[model samples]
Target: MNTIDLQVPHVIWWKDPALRNLYLAMPVLMLAATINGYDGSLLNGLQTMDSWQNYFGNPSGSRLGLFTAIMNLGGFSALPFAPYIADFFGRRIGTALGIMIMILGIILQVAPGVTSNMFIGGRFLVGFGSNISIGAAPLLIMELAYPQHRGKLTTLYNTLWYVGSIIAAWTVYGTIKYSGSVAWRVPVALQALMPFIQLIGVFFLPESPRWLCSKGRYTEAMAILVKYHANGNPDSDFVLAEFAEIQETLRLERESAKLGWAIFLKTPGNRRRLLLIVLTSFFSQCSGNGLVSYYLHDILSSVGITNTTDQSLFNGGLQIWSWLVSICFSVCLVDRLGRKTLFLIAGVGMLVTFSIWTGCSAAYSQTGNTGAGSAVLAMIFLFYGVAGFAWPGLTVGYSSEILPYGIRAKGLSLCLGITALSGVLNQYVNPIGLAHLAWKFYFVYIVILVIEVLCIWFLFVETKGPTLEEIGRLFDGHETQYVESEEDKA
Candidate 1:
């Protein structure tokens, strides 16, 4: 597949002052992923802390399930309304509002003598606020990025999840050396740090130009495109072509939006898009990742590695490995390997590694073989490495880019909502399944992974070359006309 259109005018981003500044400001938006990553790792790490376990009276079974799953429940509650906030108020304001709610959640979680019920409430608020901010942040990044670099920038967005994960893992590890509530509370309190940085950064970000055009502010939208995308060249052919494409695409989408809620399923192409969206959302969370992501302590126990410090170290090392692998894939391989290919690699790699992991578990159980137990540990790291290639990076970016501007926010909302729903189901079921069945629980995911690989092979589409607006052509055969001047042809 082709890369972003080479015919489009190119600027060396770092050499241009405005473009360089815009790129510098992007990490603020990416902190949404960081917050999410930290939450997952923090909860997983807390389960290992003696202080946390004693403070909460050693929650287990349904009680422990509720603690971890409530955040996703909170996120699910916000999904229906998150799109309205992003679409109507604009991405910047929506982001700021979400961050404020997250800060409130941090306060409740770290408050003195917080009860189990109160802690659950705090997590719910974090999930709710996080959904709102996350739904809007990626939209801003994708819409604001220059056309030539759009795919890479958006793919790079979710990779920050591991950055947050790495921080949380090490923070929890370091604090465990302390002897009181302060150990766990410090990590919970620090969850606010990413959102605080985001709150400051959101103000300086330019609003989406496509959103501006949707609101009938074409002149302002065009000015932004010229300044940041074309380095203030009013006469640049690339800018003019890009502006015309956005104008035409939005015009067509407006007419289609007249169908109201039916627009997502009214056509065959729309049906295909919906199918991919659901599959991508579901596969992202349910592909055996929940086993490792949230319950590493239990998984380690099964394999006979029961030391607390060793478990924490393994968690920290996994996060670092994941972050580095995700960066390599996001920056160097995403476009070159193509979306469909990466999904396949991740699906098949996971199925193979996880199958081996399950077998190792069984072998360790039957023979008390240390080698079989060690293989289980190796499989855990390998399973996550496969997941890093696609799950953390492509799930959000691909879902958002496939839909047209008219329903982009709604489509993303659907993606996130299903993601939260699946997460809730997994978090609730995983611990109980592990508690009751132990090593046998591995078979369930082994079966699920087989189905995942099949679905990806038959259903996933390649979307490597087109600009965001032009991607509609792949799904709906939407045609656009960009009349270039003779000078631009040269």
Candidate 2:
């Protein structure tokens, strides 16, 4: 079999020199995902600490909900303005500034916070500062990655989210034995580690070449593209072709004046992009993942696993499993399997797992049956398996590639903004729902999963295998400028 004609699809690595620098920059962007994941679990573990509560006003009832909601609220509140910062200053500075605000937030949280309000304020600032970094990571990868590797690279950030979560889970778990504020304070203080690592890494990485080109820094853009995509070969035909494609696309975006906030609603294609993005983001949250992600300890308690140490260990093990699943799925399967197939598989599997999970939970709650509770525990692992392959992996990468460059960063901001709102609602209501609705609360997710499946079948499209610029054609007519050569796309 001739290699040229065979054209088999395989995940390539360790060959390209450009990938060396690209891989180096990836850790910087991935820190945002890791921190996002860490926040989900750190607070979970902190809440279990008696000393943490005694020091922080022992919040309960509505106040407890407010504690969690503030972070999501701060993030949503920041999104509208944050995108403007990203669009104006470029992704690198936007990320640094966001991380700076986060550093301030962490300082407040660790400063012997003797009041509930202090921790709340610190958590709020943490969300406010972190949103830009989270939103910008995907955009940076989308613009900088080669067409063949773009989907996997962008999705890789979500996998790192679990890496962060695992670290938080284990950190908080290990600190559980410490008396007084040290148990909680030590973990909260550790939050600074990821951001500082990201800041240093970002210090060495290049700005998005597309963003550079958008600002009319064509020479700089070409240099980055050459360095990262062409091994510094400026005269390579592939480099010249990609550069021309980017330039032409930017020209169209400029001439049309389709940019900033209004463009999302003003243009038909953008309106479609916005609708799909918001819908996907919303559906991802409602799929019952957050029920486990934020409150797995409570979820385990509902299933009769009451020992604190057991809960912590179970949570840590589950997080490690999740991180491993996501890393495998994103690295190997994403490119060949395509978004539509993976999403449908994930949606269906989640729907089934959740439906069975609700039954198990109801059985355990009503009859006090050990086997029923065991079944519920099993479903947690199953739901995570399906979910790790979808929301935190495939859907995230797809959303980043679906938007145009003119509004790409802002569009991701809007997408991340919508998730923050859904997340706030979910995080706030889940505890109440657990108390009042019990097993019935899961029915809400059951219905949501059905709708998520239907929506993915009808509204979602495959975004794999296209250059980010070429993906524009799916959303707008003007972006359909590339002429296809007869060479096998693989």
Q: Score every model by TM-score.
A: 0.94, 0.92
lDDT of 2 by residue, 141-226 (tens): 77777766777788787788888889999999999999888999888889889999888888687888888888889899999888
Expressed as tens digits, the lDDT of each residue in 152-250 for candidate 1 is: 888899899888989999999999878889989999999999999999989898999988988999999999999998888899888887787677657
Q: Look at candidate 1 and give me any clashing residue pairs.
A: none
lDDT of each model, Cα atoms only?
0.86, 0.78
Model 2 root mean square deviation, Cα atoms = 5.4
- Could you tell me which 10 consecutive residues in candidate 1 have the lowest summed lDDT? 479-488
Candidate 2, residue 213: how far the Cα is off, in Å = 2.2
Give the number of colliding residue pairs in candidate 2. Answer: 0
Question: Residue 257 in model 2: shift from native, Å?
Answer: 4.0
Give me the displacement of residue 175 in model 2, in angstroms: 0.3
Sliding window of 10 residues with minimal summed lDDT for model 2? 1-10
